[model samples]
Target: MIRGIRGASTIAYDNPELVMQETKNLMERIIRDNEVLPENVASVIISTTADIVSAFPAKAVRSLPKWEYVPVMCTHEMNVPNGLPLCIRVLVHVNTTVPQNEIKHIYLNEAVKLRPDLTK
Candidate 1:
């Protein structure tokens, strides 16, 4: 069966290296916590707020060694009024035998404030 894991994070700046580091950390955490292997990941989709047009958040994740085989894509989030800024969201699709409820999702950095209930 195909299961989905969700995660979100925000960057302090638009620097490529900073974004890459944070994205790597967030993805690694999600994969580890959910017990999902990179080989089992079907694809990863990332979206960043318009304020982060400097670099694609997906680029940061694709550079990771564990994610070498995973297909990754990036896009801009819907510009809803009063939406969070400098945020990058990720949705990972993995082929797994685990139950949906068992999957772990992550929200880190300032993005954690966006979903404090989930973080705890």
Candidate 2:
């Protein structure tokens, strides 16, 4: 079965360094928490709030060792009047046997507010 692992993180500033760093951090945490191998990943979809334009977060995923071949796409999240700012969100689609409820979704920094119910 294929499952989607969701995660989100907020950047302190709109810079290439912060965007890539925070995204890589979030991706690493997701892999560790879910026990997923880079080979098992199908694709990664990343989106940022309108305020974020300094970099493409997908570059961070490719920078990871063994993650160079993973398919990744980046886009801007729907611009909502009340949407959170400086936020990066990811949906990792992977081939996994684990049940949906068993999967852990991660939220970091201000992005944690996006999914309060998933926080520990």
Candidate 3:
């Protein structure tokens, strides 16, 4: 079966460095929490709020040796009124035997407010 692991994080600044670091942090947590292996990942989709134009968040994962072959895409999130700022969200699609209800979703920093129910 295929499953999706969701995660989001806020960037402290609008620079490429912060975007890359925060994206990496979110991805790492998602992988750990969900027990995901990059080899099993089907694809990774990442999005950032419109205000973030420093870099493609996918660039952060591209540095991972196992993720080199994983298809990754990055886009801009819709500009909604009062939407979270400097936020990067990721949806990782993976081939796994894990049940839907067991899947773990991660939200860090200010992004935690987006899904209080999922927060640990």
Which candidate tops TM-score? 2
- lDDT for model 1: 0.85
Better of 1 and 3 by lDDT: 3
Q: Worst ten-residue run, lDDT, model 1?
A: 53-62
Ranking of all candidate structures by their TM-score, best first: 2, 3, 1
Q: Counting only residues 3 or more apart in sequence or on different chains, how many pairs clash (N, Cα, C under 3 Å) in candidate 1?
A: 0
Better of 2 and 3 by lDDT: 2
Q: Residue 84 in model 2: shift from native, Å?
A: 0.7
lDDT score for candidate 3 against the true structure: 0.91
**What is the lDDT for 64 in model 1?**
73
Q: Could you give candidate 2's per-residue lDDT for residues 5-107 as a string of tens digits?
A: 9999999889999999999999999999999898999999999999999999999999999999999999999999988999999999999999999899999
Regions more than 4 Å wrong, model 3: none
Give all candidate RMSDs, comma-separated: 1.4, 0.6, 0.8
Residue 40 C-alpha lDDT in model 1 = 86
Q: CA shift at 87, candidate 3, in angstroms?
A: 0.4
lDDT of the structure predicted as candidate 2:
0.95
Q: List the residue pairs that clash in candidate 3.
A: none
Give the TM-score of each candidate.
Answer: 0.91, 0.98, 0.97
* Total clashes in model 2, counting residue pairs 3 or more apart in sequence or in different chains: 0
